[model samples]
Target chain A: AQRVTQPEKLLSVFKGAPVELKCNYSYSGSPELFWYVQYSRQRLQLLLRHISRESIKGFTADLNKGETSFHLKKPFAQEEDSAMYYCALSGSLGGGSNYKLTFGKGTLLTVNP
Target chain B: GAGVSQTPSNKVTEKGKYVELRCDPISGHTALYWYRQSLGQGPEFLIYFQGTGAADDSGLPNDRFFAVRPEGSVSTLKIQRTERGDSAVYLCASSLGRSYNEQFFGPGTRLTVL
Candidate 1:
């Protein structure tokens, strides 16, 4: 079994302030980690994935195997970034392509101007 | 092209009643998935379909939950004897292929079991 944990249910930050969303996972084998974001009244969409090793919308998450964490971070936060963020993990099951995502409870971020 | 689409954006059903939620995937997507999101939680996987066959359905909570994708395009999730605990937002997603591809999501159907 796999699990993703996001300790904070809500986070608030002033505009231009730095922000970080913590995410930890428990999986036996290698896992693919992702950060998903859902803006107000919008469908959930992928923000970034660990494998890509790239930044999206000023947000970046590094997968640390030693700590089993993939925390999303941004140097400067904007009001547009206020939304619900989810940390998800996908691992192969039984040697197949069953990439089922196990997600955390999610963190709702509020970036105030 | 349009992303995934789910029908009956909202559904209200009485206890013990059966309800069916619909999902229409992208035109050429071969992999479709269903997930359930509770009030404050992220979406939880329920089932996955590859073509017309279910590649995985392990995330389904119980026997009362079932889903089918005919012709590998549109999918339907059926819930029998709905309970209050079953109230949540049902999300549908699709990927070009199954292996770790980006899954496009729908707006989701808010199911409320009263």
Candidate 2:
């Protein structure tokens, strides 16, 4: 079984403040972690993936295997960053080779201007 | 260069009725996926199709849910004896292949069970 947990349901930060959205996961094998974002009236889109190790839209997330966590972080928050963010996990399980994302409940980030 | 698209942006139906949602993936994409998002929850995988075959249907909640991607380019999700709990946003995504490719998502169809 695989699961992703996002502790905060809602997070608020003023513009230019640093923001961090916590995510924890439970999976037996090596897992791939990803962050997805959905803006107001917009479709869900990929924010960043751990494997890439590259920041997207001024946000970056590092996968910590020892801690079993992948927290999304941004140095300076902008009002436009307000949206729903989800942490997802994918990995091979039970020998059946298929990649399906298991997502967290989601964290709604409100960047106050 | 068009992205994934889903038909009937919104649908309202009564309990015990049947309904279908459609998805049109990007041209040349070989992998299509279906997901459901309940209120205040993130999207949950429902099914995955590789080409014309279903690579995974394990995420489906029950037998009432069924999906098909006959031509490998478009797909449809069907629900029978729909319940109020089935009301949610049905999301469709597509990727060039099933591996670690970035999946492009559609706007999603909002299903409301009355």
Clashing pairs in 2: none
Minimal lDDT window, size 10, model 1 chain B: B96-105
TM-score of the second chain of model 2 compared to its true counterpart: 0.98
TM-score of each: 0.97, 0.97
Tens-digit lDDT track for model 2 on B63-95? 999999998899999999999999999999999
What DockQ score does model 1 reach against the true complex? 0.78
Task: Name the candidate that leads on lDDT.
Answer: 1
lDDT of 1: 0.94
- For each candidate, the alpha-carbon lDDT, in order, equals 0.94, 0.93
Across A1-113, the per-residue lDDT of candidate 1 in tens digits comes to: 79999999999999999999999999988799999999999999999999999999999999999999999999999999999999999986557454788999999999999
Assess chain B of each prediction and give its TM-score: 0.98, 0.98
Q: What does the lDDT come to for candidate 2?
A: 0.93
